[model samples]
Target: MMRGVMNRKVPKEILDLFEKYMDNKVRHLNRKDAIHMLRAEFGLDEEQASTMFDTFDKDKNGQMSIWEFQQFYVCMGTQPSNPHSSAQEVVQKFKDIDADGSGKIDVNEAKEGLKTLKTATGRDLDPKEIEFFIETTADDDGQIDLGAFTNLLYRLKLYNAPPPPKDVKLKNPKKD
Candidate 1:
């Protein structure tokens, strides 16, 4: 059985791996870059990728230097492990829901996504449920990005269910 370590120090091997992706151009891993790396190298899903990025982007500069990346690994090393999804699938889902290309999902877009969910599953999720999801996922800015949304879907187990092969036709629900 593998033992989990709780020390807040990144192992040298991981740091070496991070160095391979570092370059003079950015000299750091931005959120986009982190997403790509986490997907390709770590096989983390959209939510996991985003969580990893946010945890390590210490300065919130939207980017992480190699040093910062190291810190992230250290943090991960100290945390309890949880299951995650394949990065590709999660990333695709996030892209599908982003709708506005703003890198975050606003309330309106989240509502539309809920509609899509209803059409696909034939399950009418309660308005209160949707509001709770929005409230839990949204950041301080009153919007949730792909990462937070991914986490929400993950917790709901919606991320694991097989998605429809094609888009689900949506009917505008008549609001009384």
Candidate 2:
């Protein structure tokens, strides 16, 4: 088994590998670059690399900045191993939801995606709650970007976050 990379400082070689695949223009790694690095350097299969991308996509933007990558490395070092659309599947679903190919899931597409996915919450999600969930994931213009939607799907399948209580009102929930 591969050791938890974060158990100690991330090795220099791994750090070098990150740079080896990183996009110099943006100084970050997109989904493809990250997956390539994970596979080439760590011998992760496609599913594993995709899952790690979800874990590492702190902002849910489908991209990993240097700080996000390092922070993920540090956190990974500290966590216990636990037991996904597999990871690429979640990503593909996100792409499918991006019907217009704008690389983002607009409100209309999000509604459609809600249909494709089974309700993660044990109880059937009410339309209002579904509306709220999409609302929360949306940007100011009311669109769910690929990162936001992918992370949501990942969380739904993996973490199973509970829907908020009906009586509760979030005055200002944090985004990203």
Candidate 3:
């Protein structure tokens, strides 16, 4: 037997979605998929979808896992879903907004990050919502450090749910 960490079981719904996504040959979800998924499922526009995706995919990996998807969805005022799109674009946008190349977004940088999202969407998200999202997703040290951000993005991109949402969430609130 291969002595490797047992691959975490993926929820069936997520596995189905992954199969569908793979049938489309999308090794990783891209900007278009992200936008389409959001619009079809959440009624968000291209800009809003893009901004949300960029926010979640902090590592720019062009994919997202369930955990990362949940955080991003919550941040965007939406319920998390099975097979949510990738967070790669979000990470790249974060880096671009950092400007100083410091790999961490301070309060001011965080505000600027929101501005970038607003510009992308042509409207400002609620300030409280923005703060809530940042505070919840930021590192324990209260910084949007690069590694933490990237890990979040990677989680979202690589997520593979093997069962239904109800069962999955009920069985494991904090999936490892």
Tens-digit lDDT string for candidate 2 (146-167): 4466556644545355666777
lDDT of 1 by residue, 67-170 (tens): 77655444333222321334344555666777878777888888777655542345655555566566766777778765565456554644333333344532
Task: Quote model 3's TM-score.
Answer: 0.35
Best by TM-score: 2
**What would you estimate as the lDDT of candidate 1?**
0.59
- Pitting candidate 1 against candidate 3, the one with the higher TM-score is 1
Error of 2 at 51 (Å): 15
lDDT of 3 by residue, 50-116 (tens): 6566766667786654445545454433223522333334446667867787767776677667644
Candidate 1 is scored at a TM of 0.47
Better of 2 and 3 by lDDT: 2
Decide which is better by lDDT, 1 or 2.
2
State every prediction's TM-score relative to the real structure: 0.47, 0.50, 0.35
* Candidate 1 error regions (>4 Å): 1-39, 42-51, 55-85, 118-124, 158-176
